[model samples]
Target: MKRSSFFSVSLAIAGAAALAVAVTAPASAATPSAATPDTSGVYSVHPIVEKAGLSTSAVTPSLTPAQCLAQTAGRVACQTPDSIRAAYDIPATINGVPAGTGQTVVIVDAFGSPTVQSDLAAFSGAFGLPTPNLTVYYPGGKPTWTGKKTQTGWAEETSLDVQWAHAVAPGANIALVVAANDRGATIDNAIKYAVDNKLGNVLSMSFGEADNLIKSPNANNGQTAQGVKALAQGAAQGMSLFASSGDSGSDNGAGFANYAFPASDLNVTSVGGTNLWAGSGLNQPRETVWGDFANCPLTCAFGVVGETGGAPSLFTSKQGSDVAYNASVYTGVLTYLGFLGGANNGLYFFGGTSAGSPQWAALTADTIQAVGHTVGNVGQQAQSWASKGLLYDVTVGSNTTPTFSGGYSATAGWDRPTGWGTPDVNGIIAALK
Candidate 1:
């Protein structure tokens, strides 16, 4: 997610205090910025890693919410695939067959991860998920990686996108579409390639820029417009699209009602973030808008102030987020990545709207399998599902940050922060049929 100049200054001050705390910890502990790449270009984009790098020496399989809180000293709560499925009422099988079979999920990212296949295999083996038929395609040609922050950061994004999508729909095939670079034309053209080739039933884009930047004549150069065209083409072909609303809150750090493009586009389903409270064998899970001030638990400890990007679009009348999922750094999801090399390889907790995109794509695959056909627009179906109580309505919390005081709040039905709240997966499947 992109940040404005004023928000950067605040993060810098908070980051300084956070560095002091890290000085007394293990030398291998990485700061939030170091672990998560900040690829904030006007046209290009980056993944949203709400927390810093907390890698283990070996694969730790999965961590319970209580275990994560204990391990992180009450700083964070984590969830596994099983817990997420239970919280959302996701089924492992449908009609006595593995769910999401005979469907495909296409995940698009820039600078594909080097060890995504091996890492995904490890993650699946650890969690007992079936190994998906995975394929990596480079329409713009394979990118070279010298282990730069730009490439490595995107690599981490690829890992998270691939791993979690499979976690939600293990029986589905996965296609990882790699854009050559983070340039405006390259990434947008990659979406065109995926659409032209008829990649899959769902397309997941976990990147975006500020709507103000996208609308700027000097900044965007019609990049987002081209992306919208591609997405529209895909939708016409019966594809469901999902993109991250953003992690910088409604104003997008611009001190105004700024939104993120691609997500703000009408053809795409915009996914927002939430602070999910589940696990410990709870019958029902609770959630709130993913807005962290200086008072949040683990986020405050690391000086990370994140909120789900939402609000009315600057370009159009569309709301930024149509649905939401778990995205708070305080209650993040676990992901495994060993391609970073050295001590930076292992399990790490990640948060942000970026995490929600691919998982929603997995849900799309599940819906496709359940209905025996593609659900043309997930947002439209979800909007209709809202009245049927197929979604969890989140009426509490706001996306206000210190930088943007006028951020929108989560409302009764469909507001900015969390659109229709998080998914009730089983209910949605039943409604789809």
Candidate 2:
């Protein structure tokens, strides 16, 4: 799901678990402004919000990057695959191999996109990238579409995961395992299938549920236990695993501090969110912990904006996020999707830690190529890199929201929100054991 939808879903989960926090609007709220090039150093564009009665089937034509900027006065940064690669200093080839040439990345999602293959091809062609070695699998058989909004959201997510993972590591093979549904056990079953089949050396899960909710007596389904077992098996076999921490700031939309499950599990590397400024001319790339706390009126109340989840877990001593990546809707990356129907088959800007996880998994593919073998459990390696000043340290911004006062802050070293910080991919590749 996109971050906005996920926000409402997380809050709904919290409500079901009796962890929902009450939100009260302040008397005089400030509306968020459009992005300013002078301050942010990137051309900005805002999303066209779907109105109450608008149809999503309208034929929205694709726009150029320049057109994207000129079309809106909203405050948001737009990025391309080339710009992201340049920003991170990721090499086209690691060692003698073209980045992820021999590796594979497995993406787990529910209700996979109907048009992902074509969408991925279009995305690659638009960005001058090679066609990916892609395959899609369904553990519980292909899902019959009900045309539900949730299904559409998952389809968008599927496109984002498949496209961006390939964008980051164009040479890697991709294995997309579609779950029958979003149910805990069902999702776990897909994961178990991937592990049993040895689908890939790197895996990414771009979804998560609230930690407290997963552990609640009324909600625990043994799914977390089953997921952990499957992930542990993958780890033992040298697969690097990743999951998005969440998109609802540190409190995770619960009105109090909590963490997201799967990501909260110590076995997985929890990827967090950041606002990225890919440098141009004289400006250097910069990042900050992703949060829109101060932009509360439309951002917080509607939960349509983006925020990174980073806090100590209610279930474990481990932090919720181990590393961060660009995830601000205000600073989102471009994605191609044809599954929206009608003329909506075009490029759109998307953000969320969901964008981060697949890219991280792609980075792991390169890491595997560089090291001549798979490296499991990147969290420990990332910590070691941070200790050596090898990663990009994000020391600004906070994940606190108006309702959740106990939210975590970004700090000099390892902190809850961004953990060791964003990856300097090349530096990490060089520093890998």
Per-residue lDDT for 1-433 in model 1, tens only? Answer: 7421111100111221121112112223221231122344434344544333443322244556756555555556677788788878888887776777888899989988889899998788767788767999999999997777467678878988999999998888999999988876788888999999988999999988776665542344566667778988999999999999888776766677878778888889999988887763233238778877522544354455477888888776677689999987667777887876775566666777888999999987887898888888888777788999998988778887666678787888988888887888889888878
Best by lDDT: 1
The alpha-carbon deviation from the true structure for residue 58 of candidate 2, after best TM-score superposition, in angstroms, is: 19
Per model, state how many residue pairs clash.
Answer: 0, 3
Off by over 4 Å in 1: 3-63, 216-220, 280-285
**What is the TM-score of each predicted model, taking all chains together?**
0.86, 0.82
Model 2's TM-score against the true structure: 0.82
Runs in model 2 deviating more than 4 A are 1-74, 95-97, 216-220, 280-285, 295-304
The C-alpha lDDT values of all candidates are 0.74, 0.70
